[model samples]
Target: MFSLIVGLVVAVVLIVLNIVLSKLSFPKEGRILAILVILVGYIYWGFEPFAHHEMHPHVEHASYSFDGKQDIEALEHAGKDATEIKAFWATIAKIAEHKGDAVAGKALVTANCTGCHSIKSEGFPEIMSDADAAASYGVTPPDLSIAGKVYDKNYLIAFISNPVKAMHIEHKYPVGGEKVFPMPASDFMQPQEIADMVAYLSDAAQKVPAPTVKKGASEFEISKAVNKEVFETACVRCHAMNYAGIHAKTTAEVMSKYIGATPPDLSQYIRSRGEEYLHNFINDPQRKLSGTGMPRVGLTEKAESQVVEYMTQIGDSKKDEREALAPKVLIYLTILAVFALLWKQKIWRDLH
Candidate 1:
């Protein structure tokens, strides 16, 4: 309604401006150009409210809740020791090795996980594209083909059980605020079901070769390299960087179609979000903006720090050099101002 009023006012103002311009003593071409511009402006103003309404349609968010405290209590009751989570996973792995059913896991994956994630090069036959998925869910769901190797089995179990808890433990980063958009807990799944899935993932991991590590790089270089790898695996599907030749035209169109807004480029995200906020947001996006499309990437503390370092370097690589030159520039300006004042006084003395 406000947009409609503004649009109406703008249309009126354009009409008045057009009338005034028409009466001006200008050349025929100039007058025609002025009227055409006003017409275009009026048309845009008339349609802007409609476009605005379409872009931001009124919709109610469904009421959803998660009881983290209850979840923790349940874990405690089940003798799930946080310190021995890995040991628990080892036991599960041993059991799964003997009796876990890969066929059952495959059925579960097809029914639940296939909706958002794909294990193969060809993604699931969904209505939206990979870009759309990323726009909707913060990042595209990673291929599970190598996920078993990429993440620890213990962490995987915890994550599958309760993603929010796992993420909090891994990064210790807060969300935007109190509001959170946590992944739905798999509390519905039975222990046997989760174990079967784990078995499938572990077996899949064995089939794939391990990623080769590049050696001899400096710490900064290593951070950047890791950041690049992380970004490609997680972020590249959604957010694009100018340095990486990923830019507005491609991402903007896809994002606007899916999310109603384009995600900001990471090239200067550090400047906008800052280190602390970035850390917090990366850990849990819901803490900052509850309904935000950005999801927690679930990076470890070290990985999160590396990502921050990478963003900082890319965002303000010349910050140190710029700061170093500040004092010298100020001194030079001070000298110039003093000389200018002296010259002005000398020039005005004869006049006075």
Candidate 2:
């Protein structure tokens, strides 16, 4: 988190430096070189692949892979009415299906995509083949060949224009709630261009079946560990400790007065907000609730969700008996660990 803040500061400084350098009376040749260097550095900084590129998996047979060759054949083989595309997409499968033109789609992708994307030869992480390109973009662009097999024309057209609206649950980096990074809004692209690209991508995705799901056991374990850390730092300060609400006797008494004005009890808040709002508020408050007293508590989406889940489970109970017990357990465990380590090392001194 600190590093991310520092990086933002560094980026600002570099932008200022670039602006300053432009006004200086440098030689024409030197100025040109400086501009070129700055441009290159900026691109590298944004992409980061130039410095530490993750290598793309290589395609085994080069000659076999043509622009739309395999994709077109796959779509053709899948057949029109009988294919899974019809089942999945229903009426929306017609646009790609009607044209059944992989060649045109590939041509469209090549012309419009090169600036942001790369084919086999160009760019740091060479998009080795169709699979390579799809993976890099973070979702499978439809296989034009098989695209007609699945979605109807309307779905394809709508999807090409605005990906965020189309694949909210899938394509995006999930940050909780409806909030996400403003991404490649395809509004500027000509209608024909979007149609062509959609024709290509939708057709392409069909050729490839869904990628196999990786085991998330380790990921789940890490999430649990991070959740505990987040809870300790944030929630423990308010809910568990006496610091949550107004200065009254018990937490229940404090919370009764603290309902609207103060940060409400986490136990109650979780039930009121549900998982989505709670998750969003933890990651970024502004996106979820209006006039949220909760400051942006620095926790990742995954961690926030996990902590919320943990809290919600406890919310079923009304008692505050476990509140003070958690701290006692922590202190006892800390003492035990320290004494055990000291005894193991034979470092225990006389209690003068």
Q: lDDT: which candidate is best?
A: 1
Q: What TM-score against the true fold does each predicted structure earn?
A: 0.44, 0.23
Candidate 1 residue-wise lDDT, 268-311, digit = tens: 89898778677667755655555665545555555566667777
The parts of candidate 1 lying over 4 Å away from their true place are 1-140, 145-188, 196-219, 246-250, 318-352
lDDT of 1 at 151: 50
Ten-residue stretch with the least lDDT total in model 1: 59-68
Each candidate's clash count: 6, 21
Cα lDDT computed for each candidate against the true fold: 0.61, 0.47
**Cα RMSD (Å) between model 2 and the true structure?**
27.7
The TM-score of predicted model 1 comes to 0.44
Tens digits of per-residue lDDT, candidate 2, 1-352, equal: 4445655776788778777887898887887888788778766765673233233221222111112233234457766343432333332333334543556767776765544444322222333453343334422232232233233345445455544333322222343645343335565665555567766655554555432344665543444444444454345433442222322112333332322234445656666766655654564443344344343433334445556855654553332456758899999999999999889667545542
- Scanning candidate 2 in windows of ten residues, the lowest lDDT window is 58-67
